[model samples]
Target: MADNVIELHPTSRSDLLARLRDELPPAWRGPRIGPDIPGWTDPPGGHIHDLVLTGLPEPLLTELAWMAHWQQVIDGSPASVQPLNQFAIAYRRACDAGHELATSIQQIDWETGESLLNWYYTTRWKRFPPANTRFRLRAVFHVPRLALIAHCHQGHWWELDEWHPRCDPRIPIGPREPHGGRIIPAHITQPWLREAVKWHLGTQLEAGTLRWSTIGQARQLTRFDRWITVAFDDPCDVLSDPLAAPAQAAEFRRWAADPVNRAMRSCDRRHRAHRVHPRQVNDDLRAVAELFAFVAANTRKARAVLGASPWSAVTALHADAWRRQITPIRHQPMLNADHYVDDHALAQITAALPLLALPRGQHMLVTRGDGTTVTAEGFGDPQVMRMILLQILTGRRASEVRLCEFDCLTPVPASTDDSEGKSLTRFRYAQSKIDIAPDTILVDDEVVAIIEDQRRWVRDRFPTTTTNYLFTARKSNLTATKPYAAGSYTRLLNKFSDLLAIRDSKGRPVTLGHTHRFRHTKLTRLAELGLPIKVLQRYAGHATPSMSMHYVAQREEHAEQAFIATAKFKADGTRIRFSRDDHDAMHLFDRADRILPHGWCMLPPLQSCDKGNACLTCSLFATDATHRDVLQHQLDDTTALIDRTTTEFASRHRRPMPDDNVWLAQRRAEQQALTRLLDTLPTEPGQAIQGHGCPTAVTEPVPLLPDPTFPRRTRP
Candidate 1:
């Protein structure tokens, strides 16, 4: 034999045949019942040729091809002893698993092929370890059936009618029972009703019509199902029966409304109780109504058995059923800024994140607790820290932040060289909540670096995995290429928070226990900066203007802060009395600081200054009617300087100075700046700057050059 060519040794081939013969029963070896077939040949030299799969229908042929491909994969992997004997051994294993092997190959159908494939998986491949392992095999079986396509991934099979190409493979198959049997109450004991509920949810999940992130749907319906069973003293099937649905729904309303009865708490992740919040009542009722709709759309037998159409039961309830119930539905209150991370706190966290990327076992002070605090030894993996940073920096929800893909981060078309000052980077991500196309978010250089680091980490650790996710866990239980699932990411965040004992600004232990709160914090912070409602909508990926409005709500405190840039203070730390006029003037001083030559700045204090300080010609500059005199004076000065410089140059150079002449150009730039500034001065009466401001207040917030013990007060 050639040195490079791999051939099965005679001794190993004999041993492989012996092992194959031992795994199969005598019935497979005895061919007395039918005509001869390739797979049915004796185990001593039993072989399956590629020709055995010929002359079959397309579906069967493809299935057989997949089986053949899998066989080659397994045989080539490190687990197989004799590589040349792989096909025969797989054939024997298939027969051992009870796939009926007709003696004639021509008689085999797609059903027979499917049965053989399933049997082979159950008997051998599922439990087969790569004992001799050269390389791992990742064969995804796309088995097509009459109604839907069956997806076989990592040895498990799931029926998926529709699949998103960009979906995270880490997402586990939807439970045959919705929410892993948690949302459905156990008391509703009718088997078919339970099955009907499962069918609707599962079908929706498989069809991509329902989202796993929307946990409320299953919980609400499950609560309704339990309530109907208890209140009506009837089987679950009664809900499907149109005549019984109105009464069933009415009884549920009574049960849901009764103050004495315990409110049903959601069994999903949040576990929110139906008590107190009117929103829960509305959601639960709406959920039940939606369940009825699903039943109407899908289940014909259940519809027939229920006597009325599926929607009959849902429509029977009064349109104001939520208000009529014991608990009246009310508008859900918008979120406030309290949930957001304070600027100081965000700075502290950002500073700490870089240290997290250090090699493991490096020591650092994690938290300062009164009794016991976690030390540097308690930090989580660098990947988890990166995830937290992404959340803080981008204000993305946990799902968007965690499932980031490698190639999606890019520079905005208008942006160039991120290393340059003020350049921006943008990331495109698949929006998890809505079915809209990928959305773009602006991020800074730091966030862009984090993303790059994560991509390198994934590539280095899981080199063989085909996953394109930027951040991937090295050890995944599902497949070689599984990205971190939503649950896993959440758990990691919680674990990191608990171990480090990270705290909030109030000196209380602040856990990023609720990740969605980060999204709230981000949008609220942006809104606090007085970003346009439309801009905020795009930044937060909100579906509508109203949704964006919910996050941008202004509080009285925010208004107060905007007006009073700083409070009067004394060096002795004693209270200083100030007049209302003084307080009102301070507000005017704050507005005057950002007054430009074109438009007024309505932005809040916490936001970054987007203006590059070229205030002379920026379109965002604004000057009111009161500034017209000052602007005209500046323009006159500029014109005088231009003429003086031109005349001086003409005398000295003894020739016409070119347009590119440096001194002449400076004079022209000054002229243009003042000219543009003058044009924007308004003629109409409007609010104007009050109090004679010092140079510091009129320009940017430049630090005073000379150090002084106390801050110098600006002369008004």
Candidate 2:
């Protein structure tokens, strides 16, 4: 037994490495690894002292420039840290990543190609990691599982079109970079990916019991089958040919057309018992299948071209079939399932608030519908909080955010100042788990308020047990089922799309397909306001600009506005007075603005001036006088106010002065700048004029209404 085990595991080689390490002495270490500290190389003899404990996450990869250095192996007289057999396993895993990477990199220019190759070579190249480098990439990236498991894990998402699968390989999976030595041809991953798609489609079609012979009249499928065909093919059609290098597209097309992979058109149309279709629907499943088949086949071509992995060719072929030919067939109709919210768009909406993603175990304050706000258990809770945050930032009320759904919001952001005075603050969470599982819902300020208010009403009524989820599911005791998944504000976006009220330069209300979509709004605003990329990264809690981009798309106009409006302040509560301030994004208020409770009101601040007199120095300033006058004029003509034009119009401002002597004295200088406008304007412009009763300016509460859900402690 000992001999056999030794022969299998190579204990002698392990022993030899151990003996060599002991012989080398402590000072002669090659690399060090442990829980607290990452791996590092020893300057002495290049002996790698890797700390491989029972369990730990894979190390992070180094920058692209250092890929080669990451994969270097320590050269010993006759000893090495990883034995030959173990090395083979490691290489095998890396080969999978390489397979996927080959497809991703196939379109890169020579320079980018070289850089990526460097990234791989340094960390996993096996040449010899640099003297002090521990380049570890994601574990999943290293060992791509492009099959049923891959589809099950990540391959089968309905939004593959927008996700840009070919482009998305850049999105890193878990960490655990391969030793750069794994070199599989890229062609392998292509086919495997297709096969994985095939598995997903197969499973879903099997489970749904849908008929296939009923192809669309557009094709040959029946009405129901047509619906399924559209549902499945929509994504494929969108992804079939994206904006990429022509060569890549050509190569992709050729690979898809390869003889080894054949398109499946005629359907059996029979399930366990359900007879979906009596005869074959569309005898010809044209470009739809062609697209999938091509993508699947082409993906394989990249793998083969690049020598992606050691997976059998049959497996690769199967993968390609799955991605293109098979996966599209299943596409379980998202029956009774609410649509997936555009999370990135949600982040875009919350420009003023933080829209971030923290690692597992990170904590945040979350408020539930029952008004019970707590530092919830895990990311699940924070995700809930994110929904709330989205509502708050997008200017939705709690009730609105809670019930927000398709066609709820006005075309424009609701401000208290509008004549309706009451901006529509309403939204709803879409159904949860109707099809594939939906991400948790979120609550924004308005939604939080509604929940808090509802909680108070509930507490007054129930007075005993808690009712946390606003949209709670009710099931009979006899039908035991999965715990109810709560809906959140994050998904409320689609509900409020009508309320977005944004218009393009073309004067048309922009149509955002996804309902949960304020994230893009906020991000677009911030990006236009020229928030530093790094700051955007921090604000959005993105691991990198690349990752953040996956959520917030950049538009040229927004970029221009961001450049023109960016503002930075010093720690001393003073503006960083660079000449760039002219183009800097002007934060309307010196401090973050709070939504005042009594009245809806807020406008751009007075233009940058030396005591409000830089009017002459300013170039962008409209012919309007002191910005105060401009605002007052706009307010006076409030009924005719077309839109918020260049906020940089000339204006002098008075500070919002405090009531006390100390406060008055300190804020005296800027009092006219901030206070004059507030004192000058009435809460309701209509009432202010025509000798009607003057309405006090109603604004958001300061420090915000205490999250009614968060239990407040009494003073001792």
Candidate 3:
């Protein structure tokens, strides 16, 4: 996170291939797959080389693997050095042929519509908007071959909206074709149509007419076209029915467009109290229509084109199954850098973390009180973020305090508990519930200004929650509640990433990692500081060391620290001598006992001294090897602790009333001072194992928040 960071891009095509070689087996050559990279067929049913060498050499693919590292890091961002879209088209042919990055034909499952969808969408979405994993994967991986079917449905629906004719079905909106067939009209402004197109085109694949039975099955493509063709060819009886009266259609459109009705339908949505998100709504509405049109176009093909198969039997769709087939991606990590980790790209992410100084969260981008998103790596409410970062910055936790709620976020006396009026600005919210998540608060001075300014911007646009997005209209068919799910943080992040022209150290675009890398870097820094893993475990609200470990990444540093501290003996059975100054600076004490310098040398089933915790027989006790092992183990333990604590905290934090004040008090003081107290701490000295003992620095008590198992306080 310091300024001494390096970028990870302009990668060597040759080097990447070499690197990839390590990823695969020795003597590996062809593409990973069921089908070799597919190329376009010659005609109606033409098939070309299953795997074409074409003009491209292996190096380009290697460069692309590197490029994708940057691309995915930036959420599928286009590279400034090269236009990926230009080259990405080449991958499409392979995706169309049902190829993927997996190793064997056994790794494939043609029967899984979703798997097909992943291959289908990743290849295609790689071509355009909302730079992200979805787009990149859709560009090359999660394409939803069922997408064509989903599209066929969306397109069909869109066509019908126009085809049905608002005025009269017989009256075409567009000019007639030379053969006198009804043609789509020009200049018709049905906003709904646009919404539908976005949905159909976007990665939200609605399998519409081409429903798949599962996520795996290799020989399933044979049945796909048949199912689509039969459904398309089936005579639509509704077309024969008299078209709705112009007045009746107009009334339906009006009802559909009503904001009140849309809001009503979203009654259970936790964020309904917030207001309608016009862009999200319009996007959804238009998508629905586009999906219908997409469906129609593909299915309208000839029955002869289908060729009889199990797919042909799918003419009748069960509406529920059809709907279920289309699911919005449910994110687990909220933000994932797995694509960039361990590769050169990670350096940039680490650098960007401190530079952005955003809260950390890899999952749901944290929301600030005003509905602005935090650019962090790990998820948090704004207040929790302020507290955690405060700890990171100051290296101290609050001694005592309480979290309180006002009608809305407002500044109050920091000493409200006393009459001192020595004020700390605290933001409050009612306890969050399943139906209504907590509103966030901003406490950091730097972040508070940004949050307020962003809020003002939002206010200028909406004025009131009832007014909705000033930039857009909350039209019919688009529900208001969807934003809470997709998250304002995500939407806003796209805009911010674009505005900042931020790039990871990798020379790829930088967008999605946001505040997440910050969380990891900060946690790693904490581990380096020798903050007891238990302290970090509580600070992070984790249940165990493993869970907390995700945020702490510098294994080498921890090992080095432990190595120098514990390993100190000579062949003469005497301890290494240290000057008084060295002893004081590094915390060394004289003892007539054996020691291990680093825990690294310990074999599995490591032995411990007979004492309560091992003092001797530790690899750290040995001066022969550097004490890197103990530091590594310490980090691993801390990581586990933080991960466990955060999960428990998130769950308990969301729960309603607590019958036990003891449980509530444990975290209250720490939460209140988290933001203000952290700034006073020192940056880690980055020490390696040296001659040592306990220092005066140890005298200051570190406030510890217990993990999920909040221990009871004992009498002094």
**How do all models score by TM-score?**
0.52, 0.26, 0.25
Clashing pairs in 1: 78-132, 78-133, 78-134, 241-306, 596-622, 598-621, 598-622, 599-621, 599-622
Compared with the true structure, what per-residue lDDT tens digits does model 1 show for residues 1-716? 36975553334433533443444343322222112433323332233332233233333333333333323222111111132123234455655656455532224444454455445555665754353321211122221121112222221122222232222233334321111112332333544444455556655656777655565565555666666566655453554455555555566665655433434443432433334355555666666665555665544545643444323444333323332443454565765555666554554566556455656677676534333534565344687788887887677777676666668677666546455566687787656675552378878777888888877876666565455566654342212233565666667567655555555545665566687666777787677666788888888887786887675545443443344334444455433354423333344446665544432443454555665654443332333454567667776877887777777878999976789988667666656666544443342233332111211122122111122244556545
Off by over 4 Å in 3: 1-442, 458-509, 513-548, 555-716
lDDT of 3 by residue, 257-374 (tens): 4444334234545544455444433333333233433434545331323333222322223212222333254444622343222323333323333323344444334333233455
Q: Once model 1 is optimally superposed onto the true structure by TM-score, how far is the C-alpha of residue 686 displaced, in angstroms?
A: 20
* lDDT for each candidate structure: 0.50, 0.32, 0.33
Candidate 2 residue lDDT tens string, 1-716:
45653222324533533443444334223233322222234332233544321111111111110111222221111122332112223333555565332322112233433344445555666564342222222221232212111222233332232221212332221111111121112212233333433333333334543222221222221222222333443323323333322333333334333322222233422332342231232222332343334344555543533245322223233323323322234533322112212333333333312212333466555432233444532333233444456443642323333433323222336553356454444333432212232223322346445445544543443354344333221221011111122233334333233334333333334333343334444444455445687766554444567544544554432232232223444455444545322212243344233112111112244433242332211222221112335445434443232112212122323333234545334333233323334453444221211101111111111111112244333434
Worst 10 residues of 2 by lDDT: 56-65
Error of 3 at 99 (Å): 50
Model 1 clashes, total count: 9
Give me the displacement of residue 324 in model 1, in angstroms.
6.4
Clash count for each candidate, listed in order shown: 9, 153, 144
Candidates sorted on TM-score, descending: 1, 2, 3
